[model samples]
Target: MSDSSVSLRPGSTIGILGGGQLGRMLALAGAKLGLKSHIYCPDPQSPAFDVTPFKTVAAYDDEAALRKFAAQVDVVTYEFENVPAATAEILSSLKPLRPGANALAISQDRLAEKGFLASKNIPVAPYRAVHLLEDLKAAVAELGLPAVLKTTRLGYDGKGQRVLRQPGDAEAAFAELKPHPLVLEGFVPFEKEISVVVARGVDGSVRAFDPAENVHRHHILFTSTVPADIAPGIAKHAAMLAKVIVVALDYVGVLGVEFFVLGGERPSLVVNEIAPRVHNSGHWTEAVCLTDQFEQHMRAVAGWPLGDPRRYADVVMQNLIGDEVEVVPGGIDGDTQPHLYGKAEARPGRKMGHINRIVRSE
Candidate 1:
């Protein structure tokens, strides 16, 4: 159960469990530090494959292939939280899985994640577990309407969730949201969404970047502006709570903690959700910080000292979702830094790439 002794040298290979854009960024960060990455995913068109030669196109449940992949890497980490428990167990038996299986398990379920946060005395939206139509009605009655119904597992980017605006929306919403074992959450009319990306080292040291103000369009993250325009004390409090949460989990690598700044004169925060890896909200760090979130994650997972997360400038990171990628700025406006995910296709709601534009000159 103890992962304190796990550390990697410069030439060590990191085994990544998902081949999304996050994995691609992790691989690129590892390379910058004289390290290597091996991406394993079932998708042949995984964008991460373009960044590293060390890759395995195998299903998560393929135990035989998993073992082969594990043997080649020094340590294991995942790009996403949905990595199966069985797969985590198999890999942890062979190598050190950073942020550990417990963290993954908790974050994978919306109900469990909220429960865990509440147990830790972390402020979160009021929620109830829903497995039946009656349960949904009871939750709606108890928590009121305009709530969110989400699957306990296997959901992301607004994929497996629906809002219940009225009392009558229960039966249809429940039936539509197949796969029982869901969670009903009370909606907090939040003023703004913010997120803190914190890295916890193998030896218990923690470093958190400044929380970023996030904006979403049609349920997809549209932009993240760093050095969020919020009360200084509130920002500091967010960072402190984030570090405490990581310590409680005995977590290593980067963990993203999103929050809803509730309506008030001085905003009070309610935890929205947690992502167990480097998050999209922290992408602005690459444009304004010396030690970005990706590198901080690699540092933590490798049992190395954490880098300072101080920002040098304020930046806004805009995601190029779907058709947004079609127009690429040719640096005529020198404020932007373009990063394409190398995905071959551009479909609706698909994340193709991003551009980090420095908003404040400092």
Candidate 2:
């Protein structure tokens, strides 16, 4: 792919799937570049709809709506991984889809994702595929106890997964989950979780942000600190691994690679998963870097040169999940950069918004 192949003129419309906060941010970024955004989501009150110029409040399977949206947009991109494969195919036939539907299809399933990673020589946790009782038993024996059983599809924020510490727990967990294609992965006992957010342009140009160490609570992201406490060489390796995956996928847009960092003299990093869109952990880049992940994504998909991923300051991004919004008034007193997604109601464990705080080092 060449730079000249994709172009976003001043009035070109960018179609976004899944109108969440990521879509909202991507829409904002497109506006800055003199492009318009038309958000497509089933939710009537999606936050992204507030900012975008056009919105289609129809189901993903609504072929008529999908065709109409495809006709109006110059290029299409998605905010979430769960966009149906059929929906992506329909949009691709009508207009160019950024990051491509192949990335979505692979990342949406755990088994396929891990297989692709292993095929590319990327190191992921030892895993086995499970579809039945015998398969679970075999996976338990191979991957061993203290392994996690995750649904092959639609699992996120710790949902659709359970950890088994011993042998007997598998059947009950399987019964509770009840007949979903699953993957058993040996538990990775590591120091911290870290992620690399990289953007690959249509021209094959790649740029990656500094690795950020992530902390999870209730299997959801809690905090992310940039310039993670890892050796520079190891951090560089993490970024390189991310770039490799992006290029191998022929990806054009922002993608995130999560890793388990085993702290020690060697400090090995193991691939956890890949997010084929701007990640929540990279939110700090909005305030602390030369280019935010959202803007970089917009630029890349729009066929612009990848921006510099240089960080201007050390930063920490804390997610405002659920009732945490109450603390916003008190939290804003400091030098914190607060970003509240326009979610009307905040339920437990739901990601309401996030705030980024920059700490300068003398």
Candidate 3:
């Protein structure tokens, strides 16, 4: 059940379950609101450790650590969707877990997420669950060729996925992603990829940032542009879908809903996935909106009234992946707002930070 009456006054502490860049940003946002953030993660070297004064370097399954961590904070939230179910269960039992365990459980697996969306009357790519190699072959036959096989859990940024363009690719694809439950999805001929980021208050009132049009490189998000080049109604409808999912989950905090915009006389939308927390695609909100996604997330999890989700400027947010973080000095511009994650390594495909460039007023 959702914590409909959750209310955390300023100066209360928020327990964050992951200590990646998202946690770092969330911590920064929390500080601005006079709320403290306590980061709990297995890695002592977690980037969020640098941002928040209170941090717990302990594994998710460490019940004693979790109990102590929960006791110190007024409420808990997570930075990532792959937070272990056991972790969420323990945390929620101890403190108010915004966005709740149900959102985490459903969004953690592709099969469950798709099924939940479809059950809510949202359109999704045709998909089938694949358990064995033979199930993979059979699903490819049913969904037709050019389908994608992806792990049901812990897959992100193009990892844990394989494309099967022909019948022969099934065996190899299954082998590559084997040892984990998988789901096969027929490829949607999408003209553009889009996402909507929204925040739902404890009272169930919701507000959404404008949809962002996205482009990808090597399966990772490369850029997201606000005022997505789509029909107004379509953008409005995309926000509606995000609202529908959040309300259904009785979610608090920011949620991201990704979609594929299929082209025709009138373009249509298909639900791709649900992000239970702040998303990469909504990064533009930091520079362009009166209230950024991170702060909005902090507000929701803290049980405060939501800030404006309205975009004041047309912006493009570009991620500085890997060594791209090294070029920050030369990349600075009058209009570009650069945000660097205090990470030590710049390994390939790693999201180090992002820059937002406001193109015009909205």
Candidate 4:
């Protein structure tokens, strides 16, 4: 179908699953273009509901609720990957689910994600599956120490993952990740982490934003700097890698691909993970790029042609976690774009909001 033909009109409603900050930003972006959002999440105080026009507070498996929700929207998209595979399948049968259910299934499991990358000939760290203690031992022996042991599913922001620096660390690591399928990956001694946020329209055209160098504090992303300090060729390669994956999955909407850049005369970019929706790293685009990732995502899923993913300025985005929000003196300034997710409580390490500062080059 043509891009203009599929573009959602001003009065159309878009359905979103998982009412987190990403969903909130997405709804806001949609509203700017005259579209309305209907948020579907179990949390009564979901942050996205603050911006959306309609909301359905119910479990993913609530068939009656899902049916009613599906009847109200034109298209459906999810904000988080943990939104049960069956949930996507059920909703897809009722309404068009952007990005498709296969994308969620592949990204939900560490093993499945690795396999998909390998299948596409994308470079990833060496990894092995571990279903038992003996399997863990075998994987360690094969992949070696100083690796990471992570659960196969439902892990995020450094949770459900452990780093094993030596042989002695395996037993404790395994014990900690008990009662779950796990995977061991040989750690790559890399110079830095970078991510590419790309989008694919329903027509199969794809576009990618500039890669951003990422810094993690306590395993959670703290800052993202765009126009990543890397060779021009490597930056192009990163965008190519994201495009390859998006086309392979026949994915529609925003997708983020994290990479580890191993420093050398010629840096090697290795895939770290894939996020099926708009990512935190891409938040810099809000102030620096011609098109923000959230807006690009809305356009793609709405079947519009992807916008020019060009960077307009140098930018740095820092996430405000928990108590950090309290320290903002008189709140943020005009130039500093502050986005707060209307969450009721601020607990330690929770992503409360993010601020983007744009720097004009001389």
Cα lDDT for residue 167, model 4?
Answer: 86
What lDDT score is found at residue 258 in candidate 4? 98
- How well does model 1 score by local distance difference test? 0.91
Model 1 agreement with the true structure over 145-264: per-residue lDDT tens digits: 789999888888888899999998888889888688989999898999999999999888999999999999988999998888889988998998898899989999999999999877
Clashing pairs in 1: none
Q: Which regions of candidate 2 are displaced past 4 Å?
A: 1-4
* Per-model CA lDDT versus the true structure: 0.91, 0.90, 0.91, 0.89
Q: Which of the predicted structures, 2 or 4, would earn the higher lDDT when compared with the native? A: 2
- RMSD (Cα, Å) for all candidates, in order, is 1.3, 1.6, 1.4, 2.1
Task: Quote the lDDT for 143 in model 2.
Answer: 78
User: What C-alpha root-mean-square deviation, in Å, does candidate 2 show against the real structure?
Assistant: 1.6
> Residue by residue across 168-236, what tens digits does model 2's lDDT show?
999999887734788889978799989999999988899999999999998899999988988898899
* Residue 32 error, candidate 1, Å: 0.9
Model 3 CA lDDT for position 69: 94
Whichever of 1 and 4 has more lDDT, that candidate is: 1
- What is the per-residue lDDT of model 4 for residues 1-362, given as tens digits with 9 covering 90 to 100? 11223567777998999899999999998888778899999998889988866999999999899999999998899899888977887888887888788899999988999999999899999999988888889999998888999999988898899999888898889999955689999979899999999999988898999999999999899999987899999999999999999999989999999999998888999999999999999999988777899999998888777888898889999999998877465668766888778777889999998899887776
